[model samples]
Target: MLALPASADEARRSGYDFMSRATRAMQDEDAANTGMLWVKDGEALWNGKAGGANRACADCHGDAVASMKGVATRYPAFDARMRRPVSLEQRINLCRTEKQKATPLAHEGPDLLALSAYIGMQSRGMPIAIVMDENTKPFLEAGRETFNRRQGQLNLSCAQCHEDNWGRKLAGNPITQAHPTGYPLYRLEWQGVGSLQRRLRNCLVGTRTQAYAYGAPEFVDLELFLMWRANGMTLETPAVRP
Candidate 1:
């Protein structure tokens, strides 16, 4: 019987805390422990001197100290060249093709997931930093609209479960506002770590939005909305969840 407030961000953060606690009770340390495997794989990929160019990620980035830090905190960001929103998966592929001169990994492939987990893990403890500069504001506004708009057979918007009824359990799980701060999460319910786009697609399916492509702009916009909403939460990449 709870209702969301005027500020959607506030409602999401408040609701997610309660929902996360509930989820912890339902699921255990599977995500937190198993999630590290992806990070380890990422370390290998980053250090491996593969490809014709003979360049490992460390060759250019050099140990993932500064470049890696705060990298994930700004993901699902707006792409100026594409003139649209882009997910971390898309960005990874682009970097692989453009910089690494290697084939892009599949959306849910191990390389992408590992790299995403590694990057996300680097930003641990960093507060999400979603900038709504002029270039990104339109996407931000669009995301808000998408989140609030009613759709699906049930005619339920994301706000309904995440904001309005966050403390209430649905299908044995408390509905959280769906924050992206700990993206590339490893959910015990899922049995593995998954990118935020993966998580967003899950929500769209749950809401019956026909589920956009893995890295579609719709998902990117939604990611932005969620991250922006969770602006102050600490990053918990590869975090445990039910």
Candidate 2:
């Protein structure tokens, strides 16, 4: 285990850094990473037609490998239409409604996870590079407040573990700095691909706090902050984790 640092930003590392070698190996090799199953599904979905427009994501985006490279790393980006920051998942839904003319995929569902994982894969090895500006500043501050605010019966804040005492063990699990570089990742506990929102909800529940509904603005705000916090970290879509 790495030594705990006093400062939250002092020794920033991916959750990947805290994993056991065996678990890391699972993530390192696509053949061993079960999350690839979702990536495969996403590839198919990307090419499949949908909705009134009968358009596939490929229709507009073209080859994802070229079009989507470094894209995920720059989200949650400011959306001028919404006047707030939108997550990558939210952007996908926007394209569906406005471009593809399809009903949005269910949150945390296989199709959403698959498509998100697929796009995220295109940015693999790229550094996170969220852009902040006047429009996104308020949301970023909101996210920062959420991270520091105490919640639930435990009266614990996210900073307590992730910021103040990362690298320490909690219930035999290492406490990692809460970075959002990898999403639509595979968690052993879930036994399937899941989104960062799912993980956030889990943490909220674990802290005995009320979890916001899926697609909540609060969740997106927090995601924006996390992406900013993890800026410069490598993208690791479909990452395997214990």
Candidate 3:
């Protein structure tokens, strides 16, 4: 949360009043609150029984609160077990297919977002701690290179705007560091909700890289770089995003 203005404090105004205004400006209209609904859907998806093999995610993992606690904070991590860097999304799909015997959900599909939002919320308030273990270091390095690589017609890298010029308006929207502390964020512009990967894909199209297929290796690398960049920040899953 942004700090309440210091000047407002000295002027005998209630802090709550200032907070309300700050939050209100960010939450105008329908886009303000769609994340919770998505998260709720995720809860059901996690446990709802389905798929060709007649199996559900719950068949393998059980409860998300108990089983998924602290899982998100370490996500976009290098997975020695899998010999790949994994995002929370990837791990979720791993269990769904191998253990639960089901097809993986589409990248930005409701099932994916719901599970993402739910697991993300579990790590709320915990600092981001994605590890670059021996197996993952190359992936992390690749992701950083990809992040700095300029592609598409604009020939612009993510750093040009998000890293070097954060807080500046692009057309109209304010630029942030493209941090991943908030995943499964409710986006006002979409008037719905989505994952950090969804947002990154949007940027890719804008910058003109032939956007990667959902769950592609490059996307995983990008996720790792973002998680590492936001290390020590708390998860704000299902958070509001512009």
Better of 1 and 3 by TM-score: 1
List ranges where model 3 is wrong by over 4 Å.
1-32, 52-55
lDDT of 2 by residue, 1-242 (tens): 12123464556889999999999999999999999999999999999999999999999899999999999998889999899888888999999999888999999988999999999999999988888777888999999899999999788999999988889999999999889768989999999999999999988999999998888899999998888888777899979889
How far out, in Å, is residue 110 in model 2? 0.5
Please list all clashing residue pairs in model 2, or write none if there are none.
none
The TM-scores of all predictions, comma-separated, are: 0.86, 0.95, 0.83
Q: Judged by lDDT relative to the true structure, which candidate is superior, 2 or 3?
A: 2
Model 1 Cα lDDT, one tens digit per residue, 1-242: 12224575454453225545555543235443677788889888888875656668788888775789987877777788988767777887877777778887898888889988887778988987776677887888788888898887678888887767876789887666667667676777688888777776677787777777777677778788877777767787767666
How far residue 104's Cα lies from its native spot in candidate 2, in Å, is: 0.7
Q: Which candidate number has the best TM-score? A: 2
The candidate scoring highest on lDDT is 2
Model 1 alpha-carbon miss at residue 161, Å? 1.1
Candidate 2 lDDT at 83 equals 90
Better of 2 and 3 by TM-score: 2
